[model samples]
Target: MMQATQKQDFTTTFSVDRNPREAFEAITNVRGWWSQEVEGVTDQVGGEFDHHYKDVHRCRIRVTELVPGRKVAWLVLDNFFNFIEDQAEWKGTEVVFEISEKDGGAEVRFTHVGLVPQYECYDVCTNAWNGYLGGSLRNLINTGQGQPNPKEGGNAPAHQDAATVLRARRTP
Candidate 1:
């Protein structure tokens, strides 16, 4: 049997109001803006992280490294959400975020490594990441809290899940 392969890598940059350290901490606080659809506990290096979507799907995330305001990386262990069971797919797969000060504001760069573009979930995952990192992240930095989700009776899609809930699905 031929092995299925999927990989995607991309970097997105955004400006933030807080300092590098402050900005970094907020981004690492995954539970804050990831939506109640996902649950996880991550505070330090080598900590365990989990993403839950109600009872439908759960993804395991492990913090592989942390470097203060400079960088943070996590590897996916199991993705019940995507339903691809290759453990190797999770190996070396990391979501890394970098923070730095630029032009009186913080610059944040989000990178997802080891995600094969061929995977069906690649587009969704990348789009979701962009919304959370670029949208909610910027809001939090400037407003001290994320904007409410429009679908959940708020004014806008401040988080990734909220945006997905509002976006039209494409038939494959």
Candidate 2:
């Protein structure tokens, strides 16, 4: 398995008119703004989320920590069948989003922390985060809603159908 001894982190900031609590709540409602490409519960700490990006690229994320209106973090439990096949390659890896009140608005910061920089999927994964956390987040905050699909973004490519390759995992 590949390991990144040095931590890898990417951050992007966004400002919104809503208070921190509302902004943070919208973010935690993953199914609302995120691609339906992902599914499962995310309302509280310990809930799990699954993101299916391609026929073979799938990630199982577990909500590890949460502070309402402040922060949320997820542990990558499984990343299977794509660039990185070994689950251990991503285990313990965490992605976090922190929200706080700012002048006239709320501020959001997203981080994909320590994802084994040398691994094959680093770039792609980072780009995906940009779309979800950066693009989708901005849309949700400004409009008080979210884009239903990726194609809604002029820059985004058409989404691939995943009904055949991905299905909701029975919640354990």
Top model number, lDDT? 2
Q: How accurate is candidate 1 locally (lDDT)?
A: 0.64
Residue 34: error of model 2 in Å?
2.0
Q: Predicted candidate 2: what Cα RMSD to the true structure?
A: 7.9
- Which pairs, if any, clash in model 2? none
lDDT of 1 at 59: 73
**What tens-digit string does per-residue lDDT give for candidate 2 at 78-119?**
777444445466666787888889996889887767664676
Candidate 1's error at 34, in angstroms?
A: 1.1
Over the stretch 1-172, how does candidate 1's per-residue lDDT look in tens digits? 1122343366678988788888877777675556544445676777887676543246788887787888777887766543333435444567778778888878988777776576555665677677777777677766667542323333335334532443334323
lDDT of all predictions, in order shown?
Answer: 0.64, 0.67
Worst 10 residues of 2 by lDDT: 162-171
Which candidate wins on TM-score? 2
